[model samples]
Target: MSIWRSYPRSLKVLLLAMLVNSTGMAFLWPLHTIYITQGMGKTLSEAGFVMMLHSAAEIIGSFLGGYLYDRIRGKRTLLLAVLSSACFIFIISIGLSWPVYILMMILLGLGIGTIFPPIYALAGSIWKEGGRKSFNLIYLVLNFGVAIGTALGGIVAQFSFQYVFWVNGFTYLLFIFIVWRALDEPDPVYEAAQKKALDPRPKKEFRPLQSFYSLLILCLGFMFCWVTYIQWQTSISTYIHLLGFPLSSYSALWTINGLLILLGQPLLQWFMDRVKSPVKWQLLSGVIFFILTFALLSQNQSYGGFVTGMVIMTIGEILIFPAVPAIADRLAPLDRRGMYQGLVSGAANVGRTIGPLLGGLLFDGFGPLVLLYSCIFICGFALICFGTYQRLQYIQKEVSTVKVNK
Candidate 1:
């Protein structure tokens, strides 16, 4: 099926809006560590700390955005976030004092965090028929945006740092205006689903707190899986630089990662859907990721070796990343979809929060090999967690079957 056929007009518009927004974000992401450390003259530790703060703020934003999305319509909430993000970008571009920079980071995190729940909500609502394919398309568009954004940012950063932020900010402005004019409220079906959940049906009372805790654990496991990967954005550049590559080369490597995702994710999704076992896909991917991370350590300081490892890592990403949202959707009650998705993003932020700080400490004290070894251990633990989750799911299914038979 043509991916476009799966979505209606309004959803198409929303997807495009997300594409534009993510493209803008992609411009800043790979360059964020570079900007703070090289452009702004902060230490590696300082930059990592700032990034942790940003991710921490995102955790709050994700929760708040998800909560508000459940109560309010998504469009209004999204508009507010887009506007706030634009304002934050402008402020951060001017190179404020430490406190102001920290404040701006919080706002940026909140604004960015707000974007995901609505986007995911829209995808979940609009493409109910398409199932995993719909989510995969959304993921595809997002990665495409990242590819374009990172490639553009890398090229621009080669000439001027300010241009990266300016372009990113401008794109956000464009996204805000486009979404304001183009996207409508969700379709009636989704609206009805929202209303139905509130109509007091007693199938299983939606326990928001219990579901939230479950999602939190899932997110933490996700964090453990991804903490190592996030370092590719922050410390890996410095590590590469130490190996005698120019800063621009690091950016190019990121662009390569994005490109691989653009090419690989859809195919991976296709394979994943056919497998009939999301948990198995996740566990296997985690194990592969662990092995690949260890291989990266062996290739330390070799440009070819690093690129090869990154390619393998990207393959693991293609398998693991898209599976997350689908898994969350299955675990969450319909009423709590927004909050569960928020937890997923928040857990990722937690991973982001820990990844860079730990990576920096490892690189500074123990060196690159230690960091890679540590990542192997983290991925190993995540693999075990996923295995257990799968087993529990099997047990639950068996119990449900027994009850139905009785």
Candidate 2:
């Protein structure tokens, strides 16, 4: 497609690598709760706890990944990340046991989390002018990988989860190959920034503290949105199983999610092109849709109802996820880009860390209705956070202008 070719060649290569990585990860993620609950004979609560640990690990990985990007650059950081992920995942394929599975999942999370910030940072670096288009392409390829992986993952799972693990591991190996061969170190963007920073003349001062404060506000909102969103992967998947629907049915929801995102991109891009304050509007509208999704889920108990919810949720997802990173990219200083992006990723991981444990507690204590309602309330909080993030940035800009005038 013309859209694909419009990106820089290196970015295209990075995108391909991302696609491979996401596909591998997808093979296991959609089925994680199910594997723990049914395959390992564990309770939902236990599965939730394990997922919590996994996400907590990701928080560390996300931060580390971003930090390393600024220091070491993308190519080396990527190779380090994927190599660890592959080793852990391969061990999982062979051992396929209980306590070991937990350890491996946490380690895998670290590796996987490390992989993303660089991919995103590289995309931004490779095509700075692409704006939302840059991050959106990464998101698109991500879901496209999800679509392929989840579909085949479901089939592979029916045969043996071991095969799923092996397939996932193999993909990571493939990802390593792509990254080692394709991506270059000390990229043009980084080199250019380094040259500018190293210049002898005085430089215009940047608002590091204010920008950082804004990023914190943004991350809070991002974390909350993820907190609610992640329930679908944890609690809701378990609930679907409890309702006696097959694993494939649950997997189909993600499949639909990815497919809708892929197929609906043209329409989404068209609307984005026409919209005012597109990032702001996209996030606000997305939170509203998330609320609608949970509301619908609370009332509807049928398979068709779940299908409908996934469609609604995917729309919100398409709008929100890419915009958050784009906002971070906008807010970051030249040298601190990776650190800022890492914080954003870490925020999302924090939500993922909390969601499963909280959802599990709610599901275990009060039941599914309470869990669904709670998610809707969390979405409401996320809306507040998003609004506050915008407000802070606006105020900071106004303050800066006044000082400049004085």
Candidate 3:
């Protein structure tokens, strides 16, 4: 209670808003593949195509949202995002047909995409003293919403998916109200910080380009990470349903995935406290867990095996999600923070756009063995990308240090 209350107004509101929005968002996604496959009688490949378009729109929104955050600095961008998303949710609840549903999904993706980067930038702006704690708390609240929403969503979906739509729209309505009431004010401290977190040229001590280049490298690896991570949401769900598990079982796994993150926050904080270079170690160690997840999945056919894989994957997710944005905050100048944050979201959206389409194609052409093998390769490749970025960063710092001495 004290800890939550200690956060700045903007931070607290962001957390609450995300939790509220995610409660509704959670109800929509897990059922997406199932709804398309079972309810609409569509093929997985077709569903993947629709999801690809949705993700592409999300990428557009990410860039737009970033642009807006940098130019305009308050609730207006967020309100636009949430309000549009609410409209989509409401429309989708009313009608869930073929082309209309797909179009609305793309619109919904854009709306949701528009909402994120500003809040992330807000965390840095509003809670300067808390460092990564601000972002991590947001991530934690996001999954906390996931845990509760998925658990209930699964049960609600068991009755009628129409109910899922209604409830989701209701939550979005709530989200709109929260954003309006809480985020309407502007703070100049946050405004100045939003322009440039640090002076890039401090007596030739730092390269002006370091922060931007660092963000680029980070975005590249993070993109691949999402490419791998998203398969669990899209193709993996389809794969599970194909294996004869109930739809409820498919959603139950997400419930478990969320539940672990909620419970493991304490242990993760403890682990972070003991670590040396948290960002690098967390990246490397978490990808290793991702490797382990694909390795486990490649052979296992049982629900228990999937359950075990979800647990391991959630560990990886916990380590990675909050850390990436926090690292971005460090690497960004005030002027580019929103752009950097948007790029991170853009990368993830790109991955999300591609992961399902490619995974679906791979699954359709090759067997599950091949799909699983491909993920192993993807995860390994992401490891290489991030590892190489770390090396390049070291080289850049060394070169800069040499220049400073001269």
Indicate which candidate wins on lDDT: 2
The CA lDDT at 190 in model 2 is 66
TM-score of each: 0.84, 0.88, 0.87
Error of 1 at 345 (Å): 0.3
- Return the TM-score for candidate 1, rounded to 2 decimals: 0.84
Full-model lDDT for every candidate? 0.75, 0.85, 0.81
Segments of candidate 1 deviating more than 4 angstroms: 33-46, 94-98, 154-163, 187-214, 244-249, 274-279, 299-301, 390-406
- What is the number of backbone collisions in each predicted candidate, taken in the order shown? 0, 0, 4
lDDT of 2 by residue, 214-261 (tens): 889888888889989989987999899999999889978877887889
Residue pairs that clash (backbone atoms under 3 angstroms), model 2: none
Question: Which candidate gets the maximum TM-score versus the true structure?
Answer: 2
RMSD to truth, every model: 3.9, 3.5, 3.2
